[model samples]
Target: MEPLLLGAVIVAAGGFAFLNGFHDVSNSVAAAVRTRALAPTVAVLLAALFALLGALLGTSLAVFFVGAARGLPPGTNGLAILLTAVVAASGWNVLTWYRGTPSSSTHALLGGIVGAGIASRLTSGPAMEGAPEGFLLRLILPLLLAPVIAYLLAYLAVFPATWLLRHASPARVNRGNRMAQAVLTGVFALGQGLQDGQRTTAVILLALIGTGSADGVGIPMWVQVFAALLLAAGSLFGGWRITHTLGHRLVHIDPMRGSTAQGVGSAMLLVSGIVLHLPLSGTQVMASAIVGAGANQPFASVRRPRVVRVLLVWLGTVPATALLGAVLFLALSPLLQS
Candidate 1:
């Protein structure tokens, strides 16, 4: 029973990573594709390659999820919490993907765990008490801050990028920016992999730890490879609906602004994942950068209505997924606990 539950948790984690790949690939490639810097095919392939590299290379941000896993009640309860969290997050990802909304998989994942934790504690008593505030401070706060920072950085960077090319011919400027955007898109994807790939890997690790199959000392190579490959595979599938929203509906950006936004988004993701040991939403950061870069244009070009809808979804994702996670836990707990 324990082995089966553990297997379910790992499978759910992989599914979430795949969903994450399609859901968030827009963040990495939308700007480049929209600017005609890279064909959609080339952009996706590049993203897949780098995303795999990024995931396989780093596990710095796994600490938070691992800590969360350790906090859950041992045995079936812990496995169920992990399973339901991944399941709930994956459900939200599918819904958002179907609706063409670019929501945060990071928040959804965190919310799932938190929701399941809270539900477990409430129903099963103090044995499952979990630190929701710790999740807030360590993971959520950084994720929330990353997008705002991305927007500001993108907003400021665009001026200099535009001014530098101000005197250049439009043809020459577009060509150069396209090339730069292509490179930066891959970089952005790499950072994204680093940020998101560790998330599923962490969940899998937590399940292993819970079942005593492994200690929580370090990420297993097989786990990293599995998560990375699934994430890369999902990237290959690409989420064109959300891609349309990101590249077309959310903002109107030229080659220069698109390049600038990609650059800022990539830098933020890399820094947060590698240096700060933080888990952030590549979707949020990239989308915020796009809007910021577009803000310099006519106000109408920013697509206020679409932006508002996106923002509302962003604000609701964590809480909504939390509720979903709790409900899913209630629904699945009987089977898991039996």
Candidate 2:
């Protein structure tokens, strides 16, 4: 019965991870599609393929960081926490996607984990010491900073590109930028796979440790391959509504601006993945990059109100997921304990 229950929970978590990949697909490919660098179908395919490859090749640093750096005691209810986090994050992702808003799956997961941890503490009595300061400093801080840095870098990259190319013919600019956007789109997809894929990997590892399958030291080959495939399939399906919102409503992105945003966002994710072992949000980073790129243009060209609406969604994701996780955990605790 315990094994069955664990299996069920892990499968559900995997499903949630796939949904996360589906919803956030736009963050990586929207710019390319919108800039006419790639057709929608091709963009989705490329994003899915590259994301899968990135997941397969990249190290599972984020999972290790989550488990060991969090300082959770052995025998803690990690399975419950993993289940709650996945449910909360997935629920939020679907909701925001439906609303055509790009919310951070990263933030949702963070909220879910913290909510479950708090609830577990209340129920089980002060168990784990919570995530370490270094984890927060190294991981959480980067998650927070990446979007802002992406924004700044994007602004800088776009402004100069636009200025230098102003003397060029419109047709030439368009052609050059279109090709550049294609390359940037691939980089963005690679970064997305590195960052977002790691988050899913971390959650799966948490589930494995919670269920007592593996010692969180390393993820099994089967688990890794399965996760990569699931996420890639989800990315292939893509999120058209959010893609439209990001591609059209957020800002008018030319090839240069799109490239700048993609490059900046990719840099942030790569740094986090390789250096800090943090799992950042591709959606948040790209959105901010888009906004930053737009800010470089004339005020009239930037859609401030629409961007503000997206920001509002971002602010709400954490609290909303936390509340949902708490409620769900509270309702389930009795049955789980029994």
Candidate 3:
């Protein structure tokens, strides 16, 4: 029974990573794909490889998830709660992907775990207590603020990026920026993998810890490899609608602007994941960067309505996923407890 449950948990965790590849992964490479800086096949493949490398970069995000996992009550109740969170988060990921909305997988997962924690406290008393305490300071606030930071950084980067090539010809700048976009997009994809890849790996590790199959403290290397590969597979076959929405609708005038957004997004992800040890949303960062890149030109050049829709979608993700997680936990608690 324990082994089966462990397998189930690992599968659920992989599903989330797979969904992330198609949905959130699209954001990491959208600019490069849209601007023709890299072919779609090449871009996705590049993202997949780089994402794998990024997964191995460090495990801070994985450790964070483990902290959340530790808060879960041990035994069947804990397993059920963790499973429910994965299902709910994955469901949200599928829904958002079908709608072509660039929502945050991080937000969905957070909602899931938090919702599960709240539900567990109600269902089983003190076992689940204090589990959700550190999240606000560690995860939620940083997630909420990351997009704003990405927008500002990307927006600020545009003028300087453009200024550096002020003396260059349009053709020259375009070609050069295309090359730069390809490279930066690859780096961004790696960062995306680093931030998100460790996340699912953490979930799997938490499950192992909960089940007494492994120590709760460390994320095994095999788990990291598996998560990275699954995520990359998801990216390779990602939905193009998401790519289209972010690339064309938001901003993709040329390679230069696209490069500006992607470059900023990558830099932010690197800092957030590696330096600050935050599992910030790559989707949020990319989306905001695109808007910021658009701001480099006249306001009319940007699609205000579309941007509004995207922002609203991002804002709605947490609440929706949280509710889903809470509801699923309540519904399943009675069944799984016995």
Candidate 4:
């Protein structure tokens, strides 16, 4: 690849990472803002700091999991696939955010990648061994399962915690739970940094390898730190649209319920990061947890229809973004080559 071409690809990938940060920071700050644990600006600032820290610390595993082992090969096709994926995902995120819908940024990216991968395979033939299955099992499966698992855990956990705290004075319980909420929010931020930040790192590394700037074996420390910082800075800007959607509109939340939801969501994310080696969506996990927590409240307190609409969007994210990515890649293929 020409130096200019490589530079263009790198800059494009960095832009994608920035967009990813802009779109997904809500996952880290929404609960905190909703429960009044922090003001929106303060919450975003804190989450951004933690997210950067998490990204810098955990980018190596991400490089191995998504860049080298996944479907993308080290060349123009891979670069195109990654670029298309980010564009499609970021576009969908902006659309949903504008509508005040809290969709999963992780799923959007995953779907885009899948779509781009399949399109690339169809057009170029398979360039590497076991690419398809690797993507399906490693990337797609976790994207599907993380929310379900989070929902169940949150439902079960909140009910018990509610029961245990039921007899306490409302004011006292609220204060204690507020403190707990802060801790849980921090955990969620950490998980977001570790998992979501890594997805950007992996994609950027894929671009680097494709351009022959680095082997796929390991990401450079500078790349890891820089990517982390970019994402963190993006998070600092925060997505107020999504913050309103997930934090307030999805369901009404008290401190206890918010804590329970954040705690379970964080746990689910960390588990996925460690065991599955996949980037799971903190937004989806937190949403599921919120829904589950709401269900445990009184029947009248929960908003069934609203929850249903969000779920519908969640289900559609993968296929919708996948189709969009495929189409975009197809349209841009000639231009990319030129």
The numbered model that scores best in lDDT is: 1
lDDT of candidate model 2 versus the reference = 0.77
lDDT of candidate 2 over 61-154, digit per residue (tens): 6565555435543333656666776788888888888988988888998788777777777787345575666667766676677778888888
Ranking by lDDT: 1, 3, 2, 4
Model 2 regions lying over 4 Å from their true place: 68-76
Q: Could you tell which candidate, 3 or 4, scores higher by TM-score?
A: 3
lDDT of 4: 0.76
Candidate 4 per-residue lDDT over residues 159-226, each given as its tens digit: 68978987999998888888877777677888888886777677667777777787777777777776
Model 3, C-alpha of 320: deviation from truth (Å): 1.0
Candidate 4 Cα errors over 4 Å, as ranges: 67-70, 121-135, 336-338
Better of 2 and 3 by lDDT: 3
Per-residue lDDT, model 3, residue 102, is 87
Question: By descending TM-score, how would the candidates be arranged?
Answer: 1, 3, 2, 4
> Where does model 3 exceed 4 Å of error?
1-3, 125-127, 131-135
lDDT of 1 by residue, 200-232 (tens): 999888888888888888788999999999999
lDDT of each residue in 1-338, candidate 3, tens digit only: 55666787789999888888878778877898888889988888888888878877888888886775566777667776778888989999888778888888888887787787788777854356565767647777788888998888878888888789999999999999999988997899889989999889888887888788878656688999889888888888877888888988876467888998888899889988889887789999899888888777755678888889888888787788778888988997766655
- lDDT for 182 (candidate 4): 76
Report residue 67 deviation for candidate 2 (angstroms): 3.3
**Cα lDDT of model 1 overall?**
0.88
Question: What lDDT score is found at residue 178 in candidate 4?
Answer: 82
